[model samples]
Target: MVVMWMVTGGAGYIGAHVVQAFLDEGMAVVVLDDLSSGHAEFVPEGVPLVRGSILDTPLVEAALREHGVDGVVHLAGFKYAGVSVQRPLHTYAQNVTGTAHLLEAMDAAGVRRIVFSSSAAVYGTPDVDLVTERTPTAPESPYGESKLIGEWLLRDAARATADDDAPLRHTSLRYFNVVGSGRPDLYDSSPHNLFPLVIEALLAGRTPRINGTDYPTPDGTCVRDYVHVADLARSHVVAARALEAGTSLEPVYNLGSGDGVSVREIMTTMADVTGIAFEPDVAPRRPGDPARIVASGELAARDLDWRMRHSLTEMARSAWEARRQA
Candidate 1:
């Protein structure tokens, strides 16, 4: 039997990678994205791109049925944590309300399995050095709150629909700081991501500024786990395949490096990769930014074959090369 998956936000950076990963696994894919933060060119050649939003129930339902989708990879949402603070309504509308609509459509279409693109923001500020599955969720921003609520919706939907139909198998992958490019044409275009920000500055011959130089970390800047986009996408594929095979999996998993990379280290690698030499201007720390938070990926690795396969240098190099191509 052939498997087909509908990837919402499939034109966006992470979504594009996930689409490719599905193709690599010999599955058919259809993309439903409004192109709000996504580019049409980012979606691969063969896949059908349905230019629409998950908030549109009829459109989502049509896409699912038209594509004969067996599962969904939900990646469409408002993701900027800092901006989400100011735009709480929009955040909830996209992440929370949009998810509700997707669930409704999926139920209508009888598409059950889903692999959600959750975030590390669910754990606002960790009490422990290494974040684990047990880390209590206390989201600081509306974005984080929306993602946590998304998880709840998926769980409830699965539970409520289990007895009526085949069980609605689902899992959410949470990680921080997804960096590097799997393909040059599909680079991360977010204005707020560290790599894109720095690369944009370098491309324009401007020096990038570090947000804070006085954090409690060794370098006085923030430390976050940076996972290669390719590796992250691969795990999503593995999870989808597991669900298709009727293998049980945890409701959630963290795809992160056990250790993290510092902001200073990232800047150094940026310089090394781009051949730009200039000390970053230090700025005051942004409000509510954590000094360090990295998650443990043991659970994901044991089940889904998750691991950080790219070194920092390799991550930086691929990101820079892709930026130049863009």
Candidate 2:
């Protein structure tokens, strides 16, 4: 029997990669995206695509039944942290309410397995240098809060289903900074992410503006753990497949490179990758920006057998390749 996989926001960056992974495994797949931030062209041709919001419960339930979906990869959400501060309500609607609708649809459809594309922002600024899955969540922005709430909902649903004699199992991968592109046909055009913006500025023959140069790090710039999108997507597949095979029961996992690279280091790597001389302008730090955020995904590696194959330079090269092609 073909396992039907329903991927919410499957047309987006990481979602597209997961969809491709499932397709490669010979699974019947259905993609649901609202196209508000995701592009339709990014979705692979010939795959089932449902252009709708996750908040639409009726539509989601209908798609679940029509596609015979057995599992779900939930990646749909309002992801811009900076924008979330400006429009908290919108983030709550898209991330919180939309997630609720998806869960309700899943419960109704009898789909008991899900792999959530969670964020590292849920940990905020941790007390320790290397954050683990056990780190206390202290999300600073509405976006982070929304994601935390989504995790809570997943846990609640899992409990509710267990009480109803139909338990739901989920794996929420908390990704830090997701950079690099997996598909040559797709790339992020948004000016939100630092990696994309750096590439774009370099391509335009301009200096990418650095947010701050007064952080406490050695380089006086903020540091972050950046993970390749492809690796992150693969982890989702591992989590989903494991759940289907009755392998594990962990609800959350951290997915990261473990080594924190500073903004200056990333800039240097990007310059080397594109052969473009970057002269970044020093700008004031944005409000609510964390000084440093890195994750230790030891649990993920030990449990899922996952590894980071892409380096800093490799990530910059792939991203630059996609930017140049676009």
Top candidate, metric lDDT = 1
**lDDT of all predictions, in order shown?**
0.91, 0.86
Residues 55-87, model 1: lDDT tens digits: 999989988998899999999999888788889
**How do all models score by TM-score?**
0.98, 0.97
Alpha-carbon RMSD, candidate 2: 1.2
Residue pairs with clashing backbones, model 1: none
Candidate 2, overall lDDT? 0.86
| Poorly placed runs, candidate 1 (over 4 Å) | none
lDDT of 2 by residue, 15-64 (tens): 88888887776767889999887878877888889999999999999999
Cα shift from native, residue 219, model 1 (Å) = 1.4
